[model samples]
Target: MQGFLKVFGHPNPKNPIGYGIDSVFPQLIADAQCLHIVAGRGFACTILIATTSKGAIYFGRLLLGLSNGFLVTFSNIYVSEVAPAYLRGVLVALVSPWVSMGAILGAAIDNATKTRVDKSCYQLPTACLYIVPVLLSVGLFFVPESPRYLLFQRYEAKAKQSLVRVRGELSNQ
Candidate 1:
């Protein structure tokens, strides 16, 4: 639902970064990171639920929902824009497998920690979630903004740079 809403929403015109996916991608990634952090903290706080409330668990769910939504939507857009035409279909198809891989890993972690009676069971799984955001943040730093997005905004120089980063030299063809 959040993804559906974002599709129709206009980018902030006042943003110095300009508009469209170029502007929105970075923000979405950052929001995902923030949400991940919130979820992690919420999960960690669950340790205190004996004295506190079960509300922390719900808060984590809320953060996870928002985080996963943004990641799913923008990741599709980013992959579509960045992948070469011939490879685009295959690349997009891989997303499902990757998602499954994450689920599998999470399940493995849960199975491994399920026997614990203390906070470690949940805490260990929650701590593992932090790895996704950390790796994503680092990875995003090395990735160029989508050339197609830059072109749409008339940033020709930046678009060229982005293209070169992704595709190597621009052929005369």
Candidate 2:
């Protein structure tokens, strides 16, 4: 526990961002356990589509769960930050519909591809998860770390650079 906190905890041990990020450990653990149960979700799905019936569905569940988990945190952070206080309630209320819309779109694409439970279809949905890392990298490039975290850590240069990068100008500080 102590070892875990040291790695996941905040620099000052008091900030909300640190606290919230650290809390994600429990969630990440759940995600990892889910991955193990089904085994290489995407890989398994691909195998199932190509080979066996029993193997694919178990892994397909895992792949969907993993994909949803990856995007959920970002949606929380982004919508919370950018939504104005007056309309925050309304904005958040739209989350469910947006998720449904995404699912529909994914289903549309998959259906269009006409992939069967065979290898091709199995690879497609799970393979889509691989792009999450790329999407995350693109998103990360535009997000600045909280000033408090930077100040607590004494990483002024890195913090400032991040600020400039995200805000697109040093004057943003």
Candidate 3:
């Protein structure tokens, strides 16, 4: 598949830019996914905090669902792509467990806060929901692009650097 993409180009000779769609597409999708996740969650937070209209709240719920779907899909793709073969299965398997744990924790919070008469009962949980996206948005700055992604993009040096950033320097025997 990679070889096919590398070899093929648009049939038209007049085209200035052809081939390498595989490279650009993933990068574009990843950037868009990240942006969407952050913005969607931020919008959700606003909707939860300020909106009283049922329509707005419903729209926020829809956005949150879409954002959650994107998060899970992108996370699995990224984990599979970046993980070493030996650890890949284990790492992928752990995602669901973590998500379940989060659900349990969220339920506990909701139970604990349920008794409060004020808006804080629901607002507290909403605030908690905001934390993950905010932290993820900030943490993304320190995370290197997956080496496999860089390689797919034909960035050999960058791929090597990203690999080293993730895996540390390999010692020469």
Best by TM-score: 3
Model 3, 1-173: lDDT tens per residue?
Answer: 54554565333333344444535566666777787898898888889877778898899889888888888888888788777789999999998998999899999999999999998898888888888898888887777788887986678988988877876884664
Order by lDDT, highest first: 3, 1, 2
Better of 2 and 3 by lDDT: 3
Q: In model 1, which range of ten residues has the least summed lDDT?
A: 44-53
lDDT for 48 (candidate 1): 34
Among all windows of 10 consecutive residues in model 3, the one with the lowest summed lDDT is 9-18
lDDT of each: 0.70, 0.55, 0.80
Question: How well is each residue in 1-173 modelled by candidate 1, as lDDT tens digits?
Answer: 23533574456566454333445655476556645654554454443332234675666566566667767877888889988899999998898998899999999999999999987777777677767776776676687877886786667898999988997888888
Per-residue CA lDDT of model 2 for 74-164, tens digit only, reads 4565456545568667877787897788678778767866747655664575466445455544555355554334544456786666555
* RMSD, every candidate, angstroms: 7.0, 7.5, 4.8
Candidate 2 residue 109 Cα shift, in angstroms, is: 1.9
